[model samples]
Structures are given as structure tokens and as C-alpha cells.
Target: MDIKKEWIHFIENSTEQEQEALQVFLNSLKMKRERKSLTHIASLLQLKTNLVEDKMLEMEMPNSPLLDNSIGIVHGGLTATLLDTAMGTMASLVPGNKRGAVTVELKVDFLTPGTGEKFICRAEVVHNGRQLVRMEGKVRNEKGVLIASATGTFFKLAD
Candidate 1:
């Protein structure tokens, strides 16, 4: 059968809790599809770029099963992605510059399990050079517990 019919059949057969999970998953997928301005991965994670200014970027992500691991905590890889994205955003957004940057290296230290109602990532450029930018970021839970810290190096893209 086609995917939509199969999805409807599965929804009809699922238990209440399962249905809720599926609904949340579907809503996330719908949000990704509907929000066209963000990059695909950013859309998938439902990240909101809350702040961007000189040398810094801040983004927020809501707690969702889509970001969770088998143990019901946020996945480490997702945390890394969040930190990298934030750092990369800060690295690339230099005043009077139109170039973008791509990650050359990312080193993440997962300090604590990502457990919270929401998470925020704050990234700041440590060094911004003509060719390379160095950035550091921290992921914090809703209560301000440090979940992870990351350092990243990015190279500017040619215009």
C-alpha cells in the first residue's frame, strides 16, 4: 500500500500512548515540511534561532521524542549537532562579510545527560580570522545545567 494509507492503518491500530507518540512524530515531520526557510536538518530538529549578534548565536530546541535516544534521554549525536550548528552560525556571521563557513573540526564534551523540558545552545566565536574561525559553545538544560560543551573550527567558503 501507499505510505499515507499505511500510516492511517497504523494509527488506527495503535494504542493511545503509541498514537500520541506517532502524532508528535507526524507533527514534527509536518513542521519540517512547512518551514522552508531553515536548513533541512535544522527544520527536522525544530530549532529556533532565538538570537544572533556580534560573535554569538543562540538557539533553542524543545524536548521531543524525535530528539530522544533509546534510554529516553536526548541523544549525544543530536547534542553535538546542536552545538555544531550554533557554533557554525556564529563563525559564519561576521559583520560586512558575505561568506559562509563549513565545519572542519568539532570536538564535543558531553558532560551530563540531556534531560530537561527544553535545551539551549549558545555559541561564541573565540577567534575569527580571514580563513578560519574558532568557536566554542555550550548546551544547557532548561534549568541551566550544562549538558555539553563543544569547540569547533570552520573554514570560510569561497565567494
Candidate 2:
């Protein structure tokens, strides 16, 4: 079946809450797609989210022409965006009444130039509190070599 048909079928079988969540995700995807022209390269690179969890998550993208720098390696800003997105997502997993969090600080260390078919970023929460969250992020090539690492602090917003 085509993707649209498959999506329709899935939505038809989903519960009300699942459908609502799916709608939210789809709306977010649509907004990202529509606002591409207004977004920075790094923001566009991080817009794609592939994994989600309460305290951890991973995102990946295949090496493509759009992601390459003059030397054919993933750009440094793209790597930094991946790290920041991962850490921010981890912070969002903090338990609460679902108040939002904003990144207050982020620091990234580039271990090596990333030149691979695929890039993966993993983020985990190290500490969470009522008002603050700390997270660590790592980027790896398909071969599991660490390409970059980062730490972030996020502030929970009042609901």
C-alpha cells in the first residue's frame, strides 16, 4: 500500500489518544516542512526526530549532499545542532504536569570530523529537578566511533 493509505489505515485503527498524539506529530512535521525556508541549516538538520523516550532519545540522518561541507564532511554546525537537539529532548522528558523546558546553556566538544554514511546522536538525562535539568549527548558514526559530545542545562518553564 502507499504511504498515505497506510497512514489512513493506521489512524483508523488507533485509539483516540493515539490518534491525537499522531495528529500532533504530523502537525509538527508539516510545520517543519513548511517553514524550511525560514530555518537555519542546523535547525533543519535537527528537525527530523526518529526516536523518543522519557529520559533518552536518538536521531539520525543519512549522509546526503545537503548535509555536506566543502570537504564532503558533515558541517560542524549540523553536528552541534544534533547534540543540542538530543540534549534538549532529554531534558523535555522530565516528569511533571508537562511544562515546557528551554535550554539555558550548551557546550559541545568535537572529537573528530564526521565522515560516514550515517550520523547518530544519542542523548540522556543526567540530573532532573523541579526547575533544572542536565543532559549529556554524544554523536557517533555508523561504526560507533564518537564524533562529538555535549552537555546542556535546561530550565523548566512555569506552566
Candidate 3:
């Protein structure tokens, strides 16, 4: 099975709501692509912000050839990217006219190798401060076993 075929299979198996969510995510990616030089690598890897609440976020990505290492496991860098995106997005959701935030420090621990056909990362804001925000996130494979965990500090950007 090639990468495209695998993606098709995953989509076919997804629920209607999940497919709708994916379409919205892709539209956001398209808008971002039109405005900046950003490559949307995370989006290409199928990384998505599936849910966003007050202080919690759910993100997911489908396992694809682009995210695999030579031995057929999820690449560490790709995993890190997923964590960073989820954590950063959670931090940025802080209300008000608080400009934006950037990840000041990110630390990831690889708990287990990811070998499934899907990956999910969940992030929650641990502390939202005046100038800095802290978030913790965990990445898990399809079976719900932790593959990696991360903590990040984001510095609030200027107005």
C-alpha cells in the first residue's frame, strides 16, 4: 500500500464528523498557505487540531509514509512537531487581546515507539500567566499508549 492508499483507507474508516473536521482543518491550512511562506508540513503530515475548549485541546494525525522513520516508526522530530503545535495552540487560546505566544522552551520524552496507523496528542494549559503560559501534552498511538510526553513554556508576544 502506498501513502495515498493508506490515507484513503484512513479517511474511509473515519466517522462523518471526523471527515468534516478534517475538511475544516484543510481549509485553515489553505488560508495559511496563501498568506505566508509556511510550508504546512504539520498539516501535510495530517496533524490536526480536532477539538479546542477553554483550556484543553485535542490534536490528531494519521500515520503516513511522510512521518515514518527508516524502521517504520514515527519519527521523533515529527512527534516533537506535533507536540509543539498542540501545546502552542492551547497556550494561544488564552482570551483577551493578548497578542500571541511563542514556545520558549519545549521538552519531550519519548516513552514508547509509535507503530500504529494514527497518532493523537492532547494538550492542556497548566498555567496561564501574565507574561508566560505553561502547557503539558502527551502523544499516544492508536491503541492509546503513550508514545511521547512534552511540557512547554510560551512567552506572550507583544501587541
Model 2 clash pairs?
none
Please tell me which model should have the higher lDDT, number 1 or number 2.
Answer: 1
Who wins the TM-score comparison?
1
Question: Model 1, range 1-159, lDDT digits (tens) per residue?
Answer: 999999889988888867766766666677777874357678667688855677888988888767789999999999999998888887778653477889999999999999998899999989888789989999999899999999999998877
Q: How many clashes show up per model?
A: 0, 0, 0
Candidate 3 regions off by >4 Å? Answer: 1-39
Tens digits of lDDT, candidate 2, 70-113: 88788988888778866776677678627667889999999999
Number of the top candidate by lDDT?
1
Best-to-worst order by lDDT is 1, 3, 2
Q: What shift in Å separates residue 20 of candidate 3 from its native position after superposition?
A: 22
Instruction: Give lDDT for model 1.
Output: 0.85
lDDT of 3 by residue, 107-153 (tens): 99999998797889999999988889999999998899999999999
Q: Residue 6 CA error for candidate 2 (Å)? A: 36
Q: Between the candidate structures 2 and 3, which one is better when assessed by lDDT?
A: 3
Better of 1 and 3 by lDDT: 1
Error of 2 at 119 (Å): 1.0
